[model samples]
Target: AQEVHCLAHGLAHCAMFCAISGNAPEHPVISTKSGHLFEQSVVEKYIESTGKCPVTGEPLEAADLLPVKVASTVKPRPLAATSIPGMLSLFQTEWDALMLETHSLKQQLETVRQELGHALYNHDAACRVIARLIKERDDARQALAEAQPSAAVAAAAVAAASAPPTSKGGEPAAKRAKAAAPAVESSAGELTPEIIASFEATSKTLSKGRKKRQPPADQTSAEALAAFGEVASEAVLPAGPVCVDVHASEPLAAAGGADGSVILFDCAKGAVGAKLAGHSKRVNAVRLHPSKPLALTCSQDKSARIWNTDGTQLHVLSHSGDVTGVTLHATGDYCVTSCSDKSWSLFDIDRGSCVLRVPDGSGGYTCAGFHPDGLILGTGVDSVVRIWDVKSQQNVASFEGHTGTVTCLAFSENGYYLATGSADTTVKMWDLRKLKNFHTIEPGAAVGGLAFDNSGLFLAVGSADTSVYDTKTWGTIKSFASGAAVSGVGFGRSAATLAATSADGILKLYGSSS
Candidate 1:
């Protein structure tokens, strides 16, 4: 055969190198079927001869001869590096680099997935917040609608009561009672615009009148205080007296006892006027009707009784638990009672129906009272005092400082301050306008009762010993020794006599001798 040498002095085709095995230099192109590469001219000539592959001896055609692309640049390699071990080492290095790149791509994909999940969680939270806000708005609107009618009727009654005597002297008692039962659904006790205006007007007028008619100095002087002594004692009951209230215009007093008996007394004669009994447990509080001849009493029997002084029971306000406190409105037709069941109820006395039931957020209420104008309510729970707008049934103000249970609460006569005594042996005076505690005094013992005289100038605290403080100076003006814990204290209708009932079943009377 003629000496036809391989092109470029090559001994054999170098698929991965520049004319040398294991010498990868540039632009590598792999075969699609055999996973190998060859020089373009070498493959073409091999296919033309015998029409078969040199290595596999397979039938090959010219079209099967593909080009193996490479870069123009090349590097020389050592002849010893053409061994199979060196080639294997080079392949392993390339495989490692490819695996590292794939791992980096996988990490990036996982991070993207985590970011997407966090975005979805935030979106869900925002949606829930929006839904909650919308629900609250709807509930407030419904409450306002339910409260308007009753507020209107209550406003009219207050206006009539506070206005100067008209030709008719105001709405008839029957007509006022009828208005108390609103035609709307029973979800009452909301403050409407009309009611707010009416209450404000009445308060302004009352304030001016009070300023002009301040009580005389000699009314509660120490010289007058010395005249107080033990008066006639009523028949001893099965249990000690717990609460007492005097008729605002009569010489009569009503006392509720632990025996659940509401006893009436004639202050002038020092004798029992009537004994009204109905409750099956201890009586906690009693209040004389402002304008009517009725007496309201709350008891541990889980009910409040409204009775005439003549021993005639009028209405029994039943409750789910022990009634702890009761207060009648200035109109004498509406009453409010607080219970140990975590609720307080507003009632229509003449209609004998419940107008509203309000639940306290902190367990049960210990005591409750109405503002002199009847527009606001004060309640004692735990160690704090909460003031509510009566019409709206919303807590508008809260006063805190007591370290123990707020056992007793009494609003000042002028409606400017509230006196609350706690079991911590401290009494605090709260200014309604400022919504802050104006003064705090520590008595020698735990306070059992609190009372403000009709002048709003004197505050009495019943503790180990009953002591009176002048509101202007906030000083102890006088002290009385009852020898026992005084549980109830109050002034007569005319503010002429001070009376206190001791836990030993004795009622002591104090007055200035003429």
Candidate 2:
């Protein structure tokens, strides 16, 4: 069989090399081989001149014997002399279309990415809202569960009362009275069988000895006339309605005295009840006891005094320095006083002794108050409120948020909430159950004192700017121009009255529709 001859050039050389090397011939490998062969020849020539190969010992004159000739010049390919403007124009249009497609694809990709980001953000927000809703639902369920039993009992009582009355009511009442009569007689004194028998025998003998006597006609007539008179008087008499004369009186603005004196007013009648004048110096704070008519007053005289509404002194507490604030415990058994000497002390009014002292290590205590339970005391100083357990005399918590000194502290009636008024012109509500602040209300004024009403519906904030806040929503409920800085505010026993003591020695009262 004769083998066909194949020309050795570009394609033929590639096929021959592939068959010989058992691998496809690559352009990069062929170029690299050519460069290596040229470098080797140059290296061999240099080694021959130096009498030794630079890389290896070999004769160099054998490399010069190879024929070296000037290579013929390759002719350039001739350009096709044909005009095809339409084909070029078609290619340019295709390229432009391709570029537009690519740009549109990129924009779509960017749009998709933006939508994905927004979707992710919305998903996160939805998850947060769901979590909050779940928490609220759980809280409501718990409250409902706690109130269920009371609701059922009330329902049962209502149902029983609404039922029709029995017809033999008189007979039943007589029977019940007959059954209770012996029990009452036995309960009055121990009744022995012998004593009972002796009493029965004596009664029988007395009955036999005594003769029944009939009342005279004049006596019967007199008794009948008296009965008629009593019935007539009752018929003409108007039923006395229960009158709760709430003397809600505005405090008198009399001539101001040099010494601090706070006046107590009858909130229902709008009359000045008494003028409190125990403090020898400027009174900085005044608070009313929860149940007692006693008022606690702290003064620059370095003392706090307990005064009755009748202007009589009940007790006097001496501080190391001028007292700045005083608060009575909700139980009215104790009071807490803060002093400019950087110390605070808890006094037991019943025992007439200081039960606990918060040392002046952390600076002067500007304000102090007892928690609702009377088991905890809070002192304000240096822009922080430190809470201490009265029983343990241990500092339990410290609140840090105010930029200025804390001037006042108050606890809600439920004992689950605390409010602090600061010189920073803000009031912060602290949740005792969570041990964290819930919210802050800025009345745009220097908060001098804070108080929560008995119902926990309103907060009386005494400020130089004079603003009050609704406790439930923390909204500004009312405003009044207090002529001077309000040192303290208190709610009376009834939620209808509010009292504010100012630096101008005037105690103002405000009436609430609630």
Candidate 3:
């Protein structure tokens, strides 16, 4: 049985190949620890990087490799050349390939070094800025302490004086709420009552402000949006972007390329502002923080990264499989990412910790986003839209109607509606207030991305084409299918700008150029 008729001669052969490359080693070497043979260069690189034996994973070094004195050396004839000229031609071709590979490695090394240099420079700049901000914060804190008695006494009077809202970013109820919340940093990642209360407070504040918010004065008319077209010739993505997001308040957009890069471009200026290079595979989705100069992106690399306008890496959250979607919490303090690993996680921005990681037992999530109220999260799994209570990490509701896999999702700014796009070539609108799928539309293509502009004027869906529809009437404002199949779509404040990234590497900004 040990020497079966079919393989008896090969099993007992004296010839050995490198454990790493499975090729006859020119100068064979054996690990003293693991007793495994290897091609010297290949194993040495592994040992150098990980400091462990290739097979045994024990401590290893180049010096541990002992050169073998084989009875005979034989070069592999994988090409099976039958004549001298054929062998010579194979050798010549191999030599050329080796030379080219060496040149390519050198180029990659140079590029890595350049990237390292830029990273160090950016780090230094960030450190300086952080130091300045810290000093200013300390000074301000001291001044606040000194003025506390008078300010406390005159608080009601000052409130009557029509001073600008003291809250920063909704104008710092978050800071105040954090102070008041009992389990502000609950180590167990529980949604405590105090935390829920804070969420309610922020949600109420934002919802109230949203009610009075108006479209920017420069917002384009619906007619202009119906005639949407490329306003600039500039795009920064090195290739076709797989996903994109337009800044709600700034003339900026972020696009994720198939090459695993995120380019932050200024739509107003028609130039690239920053390059976010960390993902090792294609980026699947990207989202910009509502008002902060921050970005969130998920990728096939099984990680979601948060970055700032300065190209500084804020956080990197890892997952078990390709991360399909990422979304920011309404308050900008948390981000949620869904992955193909049959799970999704909520990460706290300031603490850099996963508050909760929920198992998606039904199936891996295809897309995800937060409710405008910040108290709820919606995720796509199979054809169902599962809504979770942010504080409790419990599935509170599900919208089920689509016959195909859900592909993308967006929450309306009004806090009452949720839009789920599916591979069934349809987008469904669910009323969160009623917990029901109220409407659905077939866009005639698989929906890839979805967005609702700030003013609740339109919904942009990306598929074979990108279409903008009036939110109230569900009527198409425009449908753009010109350049290439649309991959992602976004809307600037009040639909002042419509940004669409296509499969042909064009990031088109459509709106009144005024």
Candidate 4:
């Protein structure tokens, strides 16, 4: 039987080789004309250029090549190295080659380290840029959201202003629109075009009416204001009453205590009337509705609630943080709340839902109030008092002279002057029309609250003691040493009654029967 062979790199296994390349062909082809075997691709290229086979110089083309299949199954033996000197020489050559290869690998490793350092530096730079871009994107989105109301508000305001001078039911178009249009239903205080439109309409009506508004006839006279003195003192709360408000319609006053209880003291009888309890933490502020039998109170429990005279909770409005302050709208159907979350919210009192929320961006609010006409809102953000137009949600103006946190503020009934009290022991009066601070009073103690009489003739200052100032002369009409911090102050409708609430849970009344 004839034996066939295999292809290997050693000469010991060299049996067949390509005639053209002098190497074993993985796929060999034989030339039919010359009978010479060659690698198919190499010889194919040669034929294309020369048109002849290499070994025999026979005329051949690609079509003349025939594939030859080897049938060898025998394994080739390795070349045997027998001499010791020959083996030593081979080992020495291999070691030298390995050393050269190791040096090459070490150089490649150093190059890789340098490349890695550059890659890390670039990656860090990219991260920083990405972070900055993300912050900018967030800021842009907020600005866009805040700016969305401008165009709509302007259009709505114009439409309202252009309405008929006459009334639909003996009332202005703006007031009618305010009654007809419903508040936007929202749990978050995001401004929408519809909300802006509604707000502007109300602003138009209120702003118009407020321009020519006059003091009511039954206000306290300047003579009666000067004859004020301490008339009564009573402990109306278990803990310090942090705030107080007199009921505009009844002979009662509500004091919110640090123990989360509201004391309903009958100012007429100089005695306790009722105790209302609901809040789980210290009450921050409280107010009785201007004309209704409802009491509104906000607490550190992060909520504000409305209650009827019988102590039934009417509505509970929740907030994102401890509600810092709450103010009733002129209509008594709505309320505004300031929060420690750096946001303030508007709520529909009857619906118990958040109508709008506005983020302050700089600092959390410490207090809140509304203009007497209800066209705008004033809130204390840190040491500054920012006035916002409710219609456009635009920051219309800011009072920025306070050196400490603005603790409380009140708008005069005539609506021209705004008095803000601060923790810096000073009270500043801002003339809204002039947009300037017209007066400043240093109370020698932290000013916690301020109130103006219905006629705007007297200013009630609540601090370490209670002081009454004549608005015209800016002179102290009367002063009472509370012996404790006065957290709140108020005047009766006719200025016949002056009340101050102390941190010691005492309600001090000062007035003259004559």
Global lDDT scores for all candidate models? 0.71, 0.56, 0.76, 0.77
Tell me model 4's lDDT, rounded to 2 decimals.
0.77
lDDT by residue for model 4 (287-399), tens: 88877778889999999999987788989998879998999877667789999988788888778888888776677889999876676688897888877677556555567
TM-score of each: 0.60, 0.49, 0.61, 0.61
| Candidate whose lDDT is highest | 4
Question: In model 1, where do residues sit more than 4 Å from their true spots?
Answer: 1-205, 216-223
Residue 200 miss distance in model 1 (angstroms): 6.0
| Tens digit of per-residue lDDT, candidate 2, span 364-441 | 788787765455567787787766644434455556778888877888754567799888888888765545578988
Quote the positional error of residue 417 for candidate 4 in Å.
1.5
Candidate 3 lDDT by residue in tens digits, 465-509: 889988889999898764666788998766877888877777887
lDDT of 3 at 242: 68
lDDT of 1 by residue, 1-514 (tens): 0121222123235435523134553433333344345554555566687776655676767665434443465556756468889878888888999999999999999999999899989989988998999988876754553343235435544543455643556544320112111112234354347645665666556644654575765456544554566555554454464677777667777777777777887888877778897988888998887577888899999999888878999899999988989987655567899988877888888877787887764678899998776777888877877676676565555576787888889988767778888888988887665456778889878888888877777788888877888788888877888767878888775467777777776666666545
What TM-score, to 2 decimals, does candidate 1 have? 0.60
| Per-candidate alpha-carbon RMSD to the true structure | 22.5, 27.7, 32.2, 23.7
Off by over 4 Å in 4: 1-217
TM-score-based ranking: 4, 3, 1, 2
